[model samples]
Target: MTQPGSTPSRPRRGAGCLQSLLVLAVILGLGYGASKVFGDKDSSSSSASSSPSSASDGKGGSWEVGDCGGPDPENKPDGYRAFDCDDSGATFEALEIKSASILPNAIQCPAGTDLIIQVSRVFGSGDNKKGGGIPTNTVCGRNLTGEHPGDAGAGGGQLVKGDCITSTAKEVACASAGSDAFKVLDLVKEKEQCPAATTEPMELMMAMGRPYDVICGGKV
Candidate 1:
């Protein structure tokens, strides 16, 4: 008879080796499946982080340089809406768009343009409003066509620079001498040189940012 607790024979040792191999195979299979699941999760996270943000993406519906718009309503004081440049009601033309922190002065418009509109207001409703306390002023520009539109007898044509405009009892006068006639010059400011043809320097006030004296010559 065999002694109790003796070392196992070759066949039994072979059985133990088979069981160890099976256990290792199961561990490796489970590890591979877990790796596959975690790898997909990491890839998805990377894709989401790389996506673009909406507000600063420079997409459609955002104002850009050269976009033209006009004030909403017939004579709204506060806001504007985009319109085609050829639209009959269009008034303001955008020359540039910039952040509030870096906005340039209104008088410093690009060469060959003059400031026609300047706006600094908030946009949006309720909680979605942007630029609440922060103020941003943008200067809109237009070509300097000498003719002032809607004037009587202007005929929708350009006017000559330095021409006299008169508020007569009959029809208005252009470039004529009368008690009511006043000369038109490029918008002037106080302390600036008087017009070249000024015969007698007289102080005439026009409304702008503030009432300032523009020296006129040739008539009182």
Candidate 2:
């Protein structure tokens, strides 16, 4: 059974619209195990109160909900870069941004979120700097144009358990139960946890240097 607070099992359709920005990992040595974002207003311990926008040079200057983008290759403090949905470089779509600590579970992400990343914002002069460190936040995203394991193809869709895919690399209803359809057996942090019959292991990458989330699937 799907966990009560976990992402919904239904596969999310791919979007081709150009979307917003994402996480750029800044290793904070504060021992709080968090990543840092630039130009944030929250205190060191809380989540973001607003969505992330690029304060630097990148596509579409500022980010908003439903925008597509990811970590900037330049790796600046405001390292996230926005991208047009049709651009192959656009990897993720920002679904939710909140003032919260980085967590590994799906709760931080929206129901259809396929990726999770955390970022921090440092308090500047006159800004609240409680706890004496940078403020961190969780950025929930959906996989749109990036690559994943199992050769699921670009913008294949969400890889939740019980989801099904066809040989043509299209997501389908598991209830259809066609002989050629592949059924998602489970989603695990490691490939070793997949059942012996599992044929394909799709690796979903996360931000903030977290481990990959693997989706195990096989013939129906």
Candidate 3:
């Protein structure tokens, strides 16, 4: 007997095959969609990082902001020098901790600055001249960058402000450090510090033993 409005099914084998095929198609579609989403995310991230950056200078050198580009004005309370070569005949005053007793190996700025640790040593030429050259470039196994490092500007070093210094505080400190001669005084800052150096308020000024000189002339 034929049932009204009813259709006959194909073989059971065929029905199972059809269902398996349908499941596989759905899986493939979902997989394709998910892959596209993830792929897009990666591409965007790469694009953002590769965008043109002015700081790169298009010449493969990273540009640092606020680089004063020359020596600090002389007579600064704290200034900079670029260590170039060691004469080993320099002289220095011993450094004493009369102003502050900082951490065992910490370099500090006056009030309102964080503490940093940068070390430099002075050398002596001794009366016999055996070891007096304090090459800031290689003073006590450390290189200093003053107006000259490795011959100053002749492939020795790229000096930044405060990279080397000769100051009352520094001179005093160096004198107190028990070094008989002065090498190059590097005014090292905390790595990645900004405004490499700044003029301190006159109130922070201590009496000067020597007058400061201008390393670079301003528009004055």
TM-score of each: 0.36, 0.34, 0.12
Pairs with steric clashes in candidate 1? none
Best candidate per lDDT, number? 2
Off by over 4 Å in 2: 1-22, 25-63, 76-79, 83-89, 106-108, 123-133, 146-220
State the lDDT of candidate 2 residue by residue for 60-152, as single tens digits.
223345656655655444455556555566666666665555443333332345455444343342322211223345555665533322122
Give lDDT tens digits, candidate 3, residues 87-196.
23211111111121212112122111111111122223223222121111111111122221212112112111222212221211222233231222222222222222
Summing lDDT over every window of 10 consecutive residues in candidate 2, give the lowest-scoring window. 27-36
Error of 2 at 201 (Å): 22
Whichever of 2 and 3 has more lDDT, that candidate is 2
Report how far off residue 192 is in candidate 2 (Å): 27
Report the Cα lDDT for residue 140, model 1: 33
Of 1 and 2, which scores higher on TM-score?
Answer: 1
lDDT of each: 0.30, 0.44, 0.17
By lDDT rank, best first, the candidates go 2, 1, 3
| Superior candidate under TM-score, 1 versus 3 | 1
